[model samples]
Each structure stands twice: as structure tokens, then as C-alpha cells.
Target chain A: MTEARATMPPGAGVVMPIGGAEDKLGRMTILREVIRLAGGSAARIVVISTASSLGDEITHAYLQLFAGLGVSDVVGIRPENRDQAGDAALVATIDRATAVFMTGGNQTKLATVIVGTPVGDAIRAAHLRGAVVAGTSAGASICSEHMVSFGSGGSTPKFRVGQVSQGLGLLSGVVVDQHFTQRNRFGRLLALVAANPGQLGVGIDEDTAAIVSASGRLEVKGRGVVTIIDGADVITTAYTATGTQPLMMSGLTLHTLPRGAIFDLTTRRLVSAPGLPDETEPPKVATLADVPEDMRPRTRRIAAEGAHTTTAELRRRPASS
Target chain B: MTEARATMPPGAGVVMPIGGAEDKLGRMTILREVIRLAGGSAARIVVISTASSLGDEITHAYLQLFAGLGVSDVVGIRPENRDQAGDAALVATIDRATAVFMTGGNQTKLATVIVGTPVGDAIRAAHLRGAVVAGTSAGASICSEHMVSFGSGGSTPKFRVGQVSQGLGLLSGVVVDQHFTQRNRFGRLLALVAANPGQLGVGIDEDTAAIVSASGRLEVKGRGVVTIIDGADVITTAYTATGTQPLMMSGLTLHTLPRGAIFDLTTRRLVSAPGLPDETEPPKVATLADVPEDMRPRTRRIAAEGAHTTTAELRRRPASS
Candidate 1:
């Protein structure tokens, strides 16, 4: 089940952007693909925890999940501020990894901590050197050239309700939003893209992932759809609408891609049907029993806490829900 | 082209909710239909100006529009506060109208002034007595039982980001959001309905109308689509997700109805193909000259000022944009 993905020539790896709360436990379809793309069981992965505010727990959860899936060479890195983001030690960690996965938190905080630093450069370098790069939620958002700094939620694109920030430019000319359908962020993303017509809008629904091959083919994976909003033919009031007056935009095109759908970002068009070959069935869905016996109680405790479940618990939950 | 709509027996009229910025000048498809439904040349329409903050200008726009369409029997009424909303004079004006139209502005202010007042009661009474009841933008929002009080815009639905208030309750078991696709409000409406699963979510795109007949048939009209979000099978974290964490939801169904589509609100199912007979071509799109000679300057001034164009200019502007 292994491939030479990790040793592929520079500029050939994939960038996977996940809508938040991806199905980590049942069928681990997206995650297993991440591992296979990175280097299967031999993958050396780096988990980026700068976007997360919950600290090391988020990092630890990813480590456990990867280990349980048989990838024990994974490590986590956190560059707390611009100063830490410049740390050579952190850059080295990213440089050595076959894959880099960013956890979700505050995208603004993530960009503020690392956007222009050495760690950010290392990430770009890793992608250029054929290492798969992936991010979930906030992590997913920062993989593009432009990122949503923050905004209000609604169906209308009111004036001044949203802000934009720079992202790590691993993928360009598109603004990516995670937790698409679950969060209902269609408006804000439309507003941002309307304001900047050069960039297309990519919205990923939770439990879904859009894997962008270096060839510009974006394939949808997992349970939900990836919505692409193209503003090329738009006529919008994004420039002149005053106050809370709703922006008037006509001619924008929207394409929703479900599992196995492929889109070409370079041409800004939906590719013909029949996307890349589907991955082999996910390595069997791991249950709580698969967690190291020592780590079982911790997983149970996180679930008991109720409101926020760590990645470890989410990865081991029963499939029915 | 006129029908005996206004003279129909009690409880047999329609409620038209127009997403804001319905074209007034070019095509005038929606506004013309409003006139035809209200009795065309014989109609006496009441303009409810409580939702607008722009003094009488907003009222003037509609009066001019309907007049240009040959319905000269229109009057404007403004209930500035709850006291005015309770005024018997205002109620009497509503009592005599063949149709009632509420303009767009702020829903909260509109509701604060007239939600349970005599004027509001009179409008409802007019509907029951076989008169058309219609609203646009903020006015459109108040047609539903649960109105969005105030909220931010984005794709993700965060806790406390949105608040709902009582509307005119002209339509129940659903919350209506206007400027749907143009405004990108899918998330907030989804959140509101996710919390109150008992209520279905209806989002109307700008320049569009959803006309609910007394028979519980909702027909789509105008240029855009009406999105119906049904959460009957939803499994969500709306009740438990902590601050800023994206709510997890699954099994929600979304149906987008383009112009000419019909939906059965009672059964919450899309009606079969072959909707109602289409309306005749609109009385020629009104040009600026159709406006009274003296009103042309104000209309031109509103456009020349840029940024914000009055409804009059919006109505008369050449339709190509």
C-alpha cells in the first residue's frame, strides 16, 4: 500500500485543505489518504500547532492519532510568535518532515504568529520540495494566498462586515474557507471574492477535503462537497454599497463538487467527470480499543468533558453518528 | 391582464416577500406583479414606511413606481414608534387598502415600532380580508414568524453571532432571509433553524420573491432562487458547541428553487414539475420619463451621487448592468 510520494521530485506533492471537524474516527478516509500521500507507514510528519490556542493537547491528539494509524515518526511544532516562528530549530523540524498538518484555531492568530517568518518559509519550501501539506479548519484557511481574517455570519454581504489577511501562499489565486456548509459562510466568502475578483472562492464543508495536486487539479474527498465560487463575470456593489445595504452581485458562478469531483483551478473550470483514481479503502476504522491502553482514560475524559472533544476522541468514536 | 385578485373573498390572497433590490426600472417584473395582484388600475395600496430610516423618500419611490405602473391609488403611512403604530388612523388606512407594502430598512426598528401594534394588526386583517401583503428586504424578513434581529455575516455559525426576534408573523414555521445568494446568509439562517428545528429556513435571493398562497403553496418569482433548508433529519451541536467553535451538523437538506419553481410549505416537499401558469410579459419596463417630470432630478441626483442609488434611480436605470 506504499508509494514513493515522499521521495517525489520537488514541486509534485499535494496540498489538502479540510473543512473543519473532519471524520477522524470512522473510515478515516481523508486522513488515511494524507498518510499515504506523505509516505504511508514510513512517513515523517510535522504537526503545526501555532493556530491552536488550546496548546499542546491539540498536538498530542494528532500525534496519538497518527501513531495509532501506524505512523510513529510524527512530531509537533509550535512557533508561539514572530520571534519563535523565526527559530531555526522549528524550521529544521518542518524541513525534515514528509508532510505538514496544521490544526485549527484562530486563522488571524495563525497568520500573525507565522505568516512571514522562517517557519512559514519552511512550509512553503516543504511544499515546493514535494512534501504533502494539509490543514484543517483554520489550518485549511491559511493554505491559500488570501485568508479570511474574521467576519460576521449571515447570508448577506453587508459593507465592512469582513476582513481579509495574508495566508501562506501554498496555493494561490483562491480564498479558502473551511466548515463551509456547517458554518454557512457562503456570504462572507462571496463578499471577499467579489471585492477581489482575481481570486476564486473555495469553501470546504466539514468532514470533507479538497486535495490540490500540483497539476492544478483539485479533487474532492470525504463526505461533503467543496463549493467553488467564481467571480469572473460578476457585477457587484462590493465597491459602492453603503452601510448595511446588501451588495448586489450578478453573474457570479457557483460549482459544488461532491466526493470524487475534480476542478481545475488554473482554468477556473470544472474538469470532466472521472477524477483521479479513488484511494484504496481506508485502513480499517480504528476504535477506542485501538488506542494504547494507557491513553484510553484520557480519551474517555475528553469525551466526558462533552462540549469540546479532542482529535483523539473524535478519531475513535463509533461510526453510526 | 388584470385579475379580480383584490376582490377575492377573505383568506384567499397572497403574501409576497421580495428579497431586497428588486428591479423597479428595468423589466419591473416583480413590482408589476405586485400591482396586478393588488387589482391593477383599481387597486388601493398602503405603503408601510416604519422599517425605513430615510424619511419619506423610500415611500416616494414605491408611490412613483406603482403610479408609473398605472396604480395611482397608493398612500404612505409611517408609524414612528409603538404609540404611532397603535394609532387608529393608521389602522384605518390599512383597512381601506387592497394591498399593503412594507419597504426595506432595519427589521429591528420596524418590529419595535409595529410588531404587535394596531397598524400591524390592520395589515394582517387586510391579508385575511383578501388583500395582498408584501414586503422587501427588511420588510421581507418580518414576513416570517422568527425574524433575524441582528447578526454578523460569515460562512461559519458561531454561538451568539446571531439573534432572532419576533416578526410580523405573517408566515409561520419558517424564518425568511432576504438577499439570500447575493448576501451569502446560508450559515446564519442554518444556525437559527438548527436551534429551532421546528422552524424551516427559507432564504430569498435579491430581486426574487416567494409568494405564499393561502393554499400553502409557495411559488418562486423574479430573477433569483429561493433556498429552503430543511433540518428535520439534522443531528447538530447547536446546543452544546462552545464559543467560536464551529457547530457540527449533518443530515440537513437544502433545496434551491429557481424562478417558476413551486414548493409545498405544508408538506415541506418540492412540488412536482409544472408550476403555476406564468404571468404575462411586464408592462413595458418603465423609463425615467415614466416618472413624473418633477421627480427626475431627484432620481438622477441619487445616481450621480454614486455609492448609494435611490430606489427611483434603481428602477429607472438602464437594465443592462
Candidate 2:
């Protein structure tokens, strides 16, 4: 993985920096999406479990999941070292693949084993030539130019407790954090963006995937939402702070994109989704009779028909007194 | 905080480890419980927001909340550096505090500034003299002797991604993780316990509180469940591997405790809870009338009798899943 700007080239295939912690068997919304991006059942996919301790197990798992999805020409690759990462046979497979998927593991291992190798170059070439490229967890972390190698967190964002590393640079000017909501990584991600200022922070929730097109259109798809932190125009003295302290940044724009919401990276705005703030009327609430028969008696879950996770009304409503 | 075995001193007062992301005003069950433990309105409580960047805001918020609850003597402290941490004025106040409450922020900030200070010593002294000590988030992370300083996580446990550091030794032989279910810190906690089999991992969910008496009885409180990972008799080769890898451990017991459940930390068993696995017959399902009038038309909610989150039968049945 070359350390370059996180911009997608023209005619480049779809970039799937899948949020980590995806279920391989149940639902399979994400894996199936990757296959669709790779041209459906006819797509030739290469599964790389280089970051896993159970590499063989993960490789086998992906092979089963992909095969079950009706893709016949699926292959698994496990590169132990830089030498294996540069294997001519593996490089050739990567070049011929329509989709490349990397499994979850320690991002550091993935970096040492595959980054800067021949296979890494092939993945780049394949991605540039219009082949779908996707990774989960550590894989997702590497999708952006800057990645979070390690970080200490609690409830609030602070200074000097996070480490950033170079990634494959498929998406530049953005740092990706996986298992986002599930791991409560907002603070750490905020800390990174505060220091860097040049980069945006994309925290992807578990079971979610961010579909980045060559034209800079980002579509969120999954069970949860994606949190986008824009700190470019923010003001903070955290960069000049001498000792460790909590972060203080103002004017940072936060956007939450739920499933089916479409955002444009180039425009830095929401392109398509229901309930835009400028709309005349937002989504309406439903009564008990409008709910599903099974769930109506116990609860009436209002169907959220918008790109946002919480409305202005909901956010104003206090969690407690 | 001294690094010691995880055992409570006989004369020590009650310790409340609250999970993170709680609403201070509404549904303030955990906070109310802490006040009650401190002997109600007559209690002198100290609020430490040193762990928070919004410490001033948190202090003000808690002061109002506690005052609303009828606690007249509420003091606030903000120790930013080591020198301030040893402030005699603050130490004197902490010593006399009937209940000491620390707010959430970055755990590292809490540990570094207060770990070896006079303030930390005063807190221990107060607790030993029968004063309640309560902490939330970063505060909760610092209650145990060995704290999870940093950890990379997913849905499954892995090796080397977790690192433990010293914490305020209010409790030993146990590591605590906040936002357990919501943030999915289970894998990270499991990795910690797998490596150090003698210690148990307590993963507390948000809005919840675990009240541990000096005699070692633990009662779960609040809206969510507490996941306890016991690795006392686990066997694993994960401890041997050097690089990042999948964790391998067997015989690890998992227990989920909800509100009203009482667990005996001394005996490493649940003393009082309605549904014991050894019971001859489980609970029966409820009818529509068994639920409240408002909840009658849809799903039937089983009244969680005596410590169960739901019930034995409800646990056996599936939700929307």
C-alpha cells in the first residue's frame, strides 16, 4: 500500500472501506454488497486473511460465505511475511481478481506483511483498473490515507493519547475507525482529527459499510449509522498544549449518515436522503395501529425515514432529567 | 493507586462502579443509589471532575443534580496536575467526604494525575473509614487495581491488542470495562482475563452501576446488564504467542447480571437470583393481560420477577431476532 493522497482516480472501481465486525453468515448484507460491486456472481474475488491469527479459519470462512453467495471463482490468500506478500502467484491472482477482500485482525500485522509488497502493488493496480476493493476492521482502517494504530479512550476526546499510521491511501484526507459506535471510538477519532486538522474522521459502525465511488459519492449501507467528523475549519489550541489534557475544539461539523443515505465527499454535503433540514416537513410519528402486529403491543417503534440518526427534536430531548 | 490483589478490606465502605454515558438528570437511578449509600441528605459528597475536559460543566451539573436530590453538602474538586493532585486543601476535603464521586473523561488523565497523589490516598482512607466511593467511565476504569489502559477490539477476543496499567486500588483481582454491551468491549476484556487468569473481567453496560460492599457482595443496578467474564479455570495457549493472534481459551464462564441481581464476589457465585440453571422448571410465558394496559395489544412483556432482566422463559425466547 503506497502512502499517497486519499483521492479516488477516474474510472477506478468502487472502494468499499467496510466498517469492521461484519457477520459472514447471518444477513450477509455487506459481503453481498461487495459481490454486487464486483459484478455479481460472475466476479472473480480474492480473499486475504493476512491480518488474522486464525488466517486459515478466516480464509475458509470467507470462501464459504462467498461460495454460498454463488460466486464460483473465489480464492483465499494468506501471506505470512513480506516474501509471501510478494509471491508472483499471489500477485497474479490479485491482478486477475474482480474484488479483493481483506479480513479483520491487528492492522499492524497487515501493514508489515502486505504493505509495500508486490501483492500490495497488484491490489492497487486492480483497484485502479475498476476492480472492487474492500476490507473489514483492520482492513477498514487501512482504506484511508491515515489510520489509527492505537489509542487510549474514555468518555471524552483528549490530547496526545492516540497514534496515527500511514495506510493504503485509497481514501485520503480521512482517518477511518472501525467498530465505531460499538467500541465508543468517537473520542479517539476526534482527538486525531483535532491534531491533524487536514484530515476528516470517518467512524464506521459495526455491520455497516461505506461505499465510495470513483466520482466521490459515499453511500452508507448497514444496520447502523456512520459518523463523519469534519474538523478542517475548527479552531483549537490543543496542538500547542504542552502536557496531556482534554481536547477543546469548536466549529467542527458532525454528520450522521444512516443506511441508504448518500453523501458526496467532493461537495461535503448530504446529496440524497429523506427529511432534509430544508424540507417543509420532516418525517411524522406513527400510532400503535401503524406498527407491526407482533411488536405493537409491547412497543411502537417509529420508522425513521431520514439520513439522520436523531432529529433536532430528539437531540433536544434529554436522556435523563 | 497501589497494585495489589483484588480483595476488599473488611471495614471498607461500599464502592459503586458506574458504567459510562449516563444521563445526569433523568433516570438518575445510579446517582440516587450512590446518595442513598452515602446515608441520604445528611451525606457529605465530593464530586471530582478532574477526569473530564468539561470538568467545570460536569461539576456544576452534578452540584445541581445532588442538590435537587436534597444533598446539602456537595463539594467539587479539579486537580489538573501532579502538584494539584497533592493539594492539602483537596485532600482534607476528600478525607471528610462521606461519598466521593468522580465524573468521566479520559481514563489516562484520571490515572496519571491522581494515581500516586495525596488526593488518591485520601480517597482510599475515606473508603476504608466507611465512606462510599463512586466513579463513572474513566472514574469506573480507575476503581480496579489493574486497569485496561488500551485495547483493540472486535466481536471476538484477540491477543496483544489489550494493555493493562495501574489504577486506584479500590478493588483488586478484577478489571472493569465501561459501555460493555453498547460499545462491545467484551472481546478486549476477555483477552485481558485470558492472559491473567486469576483476575475476573467485569464489563459494565451504560446507565448501570455495580455496588460492591466491603464484605464482597456485588449488586447490579440500572437499565442494562453486566457481563462478567470468569477465566479462573481457563486453559489457553494464547499467552504464549508473541505477535497479534486469535485468543484460545476454554472453560471461561460468562454471567449476565441485571438490576436487583446479587452476586457474591467472595464465593465467585450468584447468591440470590430467581432463575438458577439447576432449577427443575423454568418460568412460563405471559399472556396479553399479564402486561400493562398500554402494552397489551402487541407483545407480552414478562414481569421480571426478583432479579431477572426478563425471565427464564423470556431469555429462552427470541426477540425480533
Candidate 3:
């Protein structure tokens, strides 16, 4: 069925945002999905671990794991500096890759190395040319247009959870946070979205992945859930609040997409899946009515922005499409 | 110097709750610390992958990683089922281990396997005998008295963030949340603390570890900061409110301790570290007065409980102690 979809967009690659602490051993749930999206075992794979200080170890570990999984051609690279990131040979290696896996480490490190270098250009270019691009933890954080560089830590967002910096920009209109549930990063992601009210916040849980097709199709797979924070219609008192006070906001729509749930970014709704969230369950549009009274006014603001559908929309597309 | 600390507590081992996605390749900041605490290269390390569904793969990954690190004796074991968790041989391996490491997987799977069986008994016994016990992600979740098995995913705590069940109970008066900063789990951890009221919530970040000595001495290390939420004195309307309303609580003392920060659990204070916030910088004790007006009252409740020191206490002990 996936192959039969001839209407799929060009330069459309599957964007997989993995929650951190993935099961890499025998059942590489997320990895296998990446391989599947990249056209199976015959695909050329490149594993990048620039986010990791221990790059050699991550690269070698993937080398053996991918080999064990029967992928014939796999290359692992960890550039020590920008000069290495700009190497032409490295660019060539990435260019020919069908899938790219960025390991967990420091998001800043990964962004610094590949953002504008030859290697970085190759990845963005490859991703645009229908190659599957996957990242876990920091790697996942760098996948969005505005990556969260650093932030304040806590359950609720303070004045700042950290800063949002330029990311690889493979995915637009959204910011990504990895290891979502395992780390409980909802607040920081929300803060990021609140600061940049136009963007959606996608938080992927551990051992899970949010797979986004180039054509804007999304499916969540694995053990955890994907939290979607739509701040497009939020109204917050952040602009008036001073330091040390709790942040107050309204109209933020949040959706928790469990494993097997399918989402449509374009339609802005959770849709029916052939294998999961089957046809019987009617599609549910994202709304604020379900939220507590205090948070409704702000959520209602977003409703005005997207009249038919809001964040966390679930729908069952007609089978014909 | 470690041996010279004759005042060390018996059956007291340091509990390292490493946030998930640790750097296992070359410089395993957290793992190396576990090794050092367990007597370095000479220690008998037992790696438990039972928490992981992909036990074989995780076990193998750790075996190679540990071996690469040149640890002389390392054993990896993944119980195929619950019954195997009681195997005498498995118990024997744990008994001889100077350090035990639990890999990441489903916290529920791990709890089901090791909670009641000899495996759990062996782990508790190992820690009691001063064996360094460490866990990441799911492993870390199981280290607390109230394990956060699963919860609502987001930045703020909504209706109960999932549930808390029985854990290994290696650390008391505290609940552990891993991948803290990376995942933005501050709210969930706070919810756990708010529910328990008396338990301190320790949220460790990715690539970082919170080290607790047998003598109850505490220190923060690695690249990220440790978010310590003391709920011993929270004032909230959780009891008055019902269902899905945003959780309202105050006087919940929050401390973000970066690397090298020393905390005295017994004193409930961030103690003196010669160079930082130097002598001119007065110690900051966590008080209701310190918090905004909303949180002051409940935090004051904790002060009534532990008169000597309370939330965010930073006092230099008398020089002659």
C-alpha cells in the first residue's frame, strides 16, 4: 500500500524523531522503521554521531549493530571539527546514503558541526531527495527549524526553558524535543512553542519515533507517545509577567498520540490507519473543550486560527486516497 | 582516600540515577564513576538488561562497551521470563557483583521481572553491602520508593501523570526521573512529589548522573544540571480539585544544581564549594519567603518538619566537623 501511493510528493523523505533511550539491541523498532522507509536492507546507510563526544564508540557500535542486522553497506562518521564537517569526501558519503541515523549526545555539538558545512548540506539535500533521516535525543532536537539549544529545567516553564536556535530546518513550522516521556520535557517544548507562537511543538517519547513522510504524513510507532503542542492560537501573560513568577498561558492545544495513531500534518487531524486506529473509530478534531476551565480561553484562541481542525486532529481519510 | 573515610555508612552504596542516552562509547562519565565506586577495574560488574525487551541486544551492547572500557570482569544477563528472574545462578552473579547496571527498556517490564524475585532481593542486598547500583531511564525509574511507571506526557502535570507503583526502593524519600532536561519532565516529577508531599523529586538529565554516597553525601556531575524538587512542604489544591484541571501547587522548592554542586541530603542544603557563589555570596536557603507569594506557605510546612535546614539551604558547615 505504501508503494502504491503514487501521489506522494517528490523530495519527500520520512522524518523520524526518536525519543531518547531507544532499544538498539535486537529489536531496533525505530531503526528497522528507518530502514524500511529507506527501501530495506539494500539501502546505503550513514550513521552520524557528532552530538556525541564519544563518537568513535557510537559509530563503531552502530557499525556492528547495522552489520548484525544485515545491512551490507553502512558508514559511520563523527567529525571532530567544522573542517572535518566540510570535507568533500564526507559530503559524497552522505549524498549516496539512503538513510541517515544521528546518535544521541549534545544537540549543540551536532548542530555546530553539520549546520552549514558540506556534510550538513549533504544530509539536508539527501533528506529532501527522499532519504529517510532519523535522530535520537539531541539528534532529534536538531531536526526542527528552530532547535532548543539550552533551557531552564523544571516541570513548568519559567521565564525561559532555554533558547531556540537555528536547526537543520528539515522540518518546518515545528520545534522538536526528544526523549519526551522518559525525560518529561513537556514544559520546555511548550515554552519553546509559546515563545514562537506560530510553531507546533512535537515531543517524542523514549523507544518511540514520530515518522513524518515528505508528503506530510505522520505515524507514531513504538512503546511511548508523541505530544503535540499547538501554540498557533495561544494567549499568554508572558509578555507582562516578571521574573520568578509562574508562566501563564491559554489556548494551547495538546494532543498525546499513542503508538499506532496516525496524524496528518496537512489536514491537521489524526487519521484512520489501515493497521491501527482502524476505521471504526471516528476521527476526532483537536479542541479545547476537553481541557480544564482555566486553560480553555487560550485554547479557544487557536480554534479561531484553524477553524476546521486544530492540533492533535484525528481523522479517517477515505480509502480511495 | 575513599578507604580512609572510616565514617562511611554500612550497607550504604551510592545510587547513580543516570538520565537516559548516556555516552557509552569512550568517556562514559556516569559509567566510569560507577566503576570507580565499585573499585575500578577490579570490580565485578553485573549488567542487567531485564528491564529491556531487547535484552539480548542491550546486554551485548553493554558487554562490548564495558569490555572496550577494559573492565576486567563484566557479566550481562537478560531473564527470558519472570521465572528466570529467580534463578539461583542469576542470584549468584548478582551476589558477586560489586556494581550492577540496569539498561533501558519498559520500566513495567523490568519491575515485573525483578520486583519480587530473587533478582530484586539480590539487587537490594548488593546495595546494602555497599555495591554501587546504577540504572538509566527505566532503570532509574525503578530505583525510587514510588516508581513513576508511566504518566501523562507534557510540560505540566495534568490529571495524575500516569501511576506510581512499587520500585526497588534503593533510595528513600525521593522519586527519580531520568532524561530530565532533554525530555522536559519537570512537571511530572513535580506531580509525583506533590502527590507524595514528603518525597523529594530528583530529575537527572541525559548524559548526567546524581551520585549519592553511603553516608548520604550528594553531588552533581556531568554536562547537565540536576533538578531537585522538594515537595515535603507543598501547598496545593490537588485535594480540593478533581479531574483534569491544571494541578495547582505552591511552596514547592526547586533547585537546579549544575555539575560540581554539592548537596547534603541530611542537611537539606547546597553546601559550600570553595569557588562558586563564593563567601561573599550568602547561602540561599529554600524558604517560602524566597519563593513567590503563592508557594511560600507549603514550603514553610517543610521548615516545620526539618528545623535544622529546609529547601535550597546553602550553608557552610562548621570548619571543625
Each candidate's iRMS in angstroms? Answer: 11.0, 19.1, 13.7
**Candidate 3 C-alpha lDDT tens digits along A210-281:** 888877777888766677766655545455434543344443545556556666665545564323335575
Off by over 4 Å in 2: A1-6, A242-244, A275-321, B1-321
Query: Per-prediction DockQ scores?
Result: 0.11, 0.02, 0.05
lDDT of 3 at B219: 81
Question: If the candidates were sorted by their DockQ against the true structure, best first, what order would they fall in?
Answer: 1, 3, 2
User: Per model, how many backbone clashes are there?
Assistant: 23, 11, 29
Which docking category, incorrect, acceptable, medium or high, applies to candidate 3?
Answer: incorrect
Cα lDDT of model 3 by residue, B153-239, tens digit: 555555586578889888876678888866667667766765776666778878778888876666877766566666555444455
Tell how far residue A192 is off in model 3, in angstroms.
14
TM-score of each: 0.52, 0.47, 0.46
- Tell me, what's the RMSD of every candidate? 16.1, 25.1, 20.1
How far off is residue A233 in model 2, in Å?
Answer: 1.2
User: Which of the two candidates, 1 or 3, achieves a greater TM-score against the reference?
Assistant: 1
> Residue by residue across B111-176, what tens digits does model 1's lDDT show?
989988888888778888889999999989898778888776555455675689998787877788
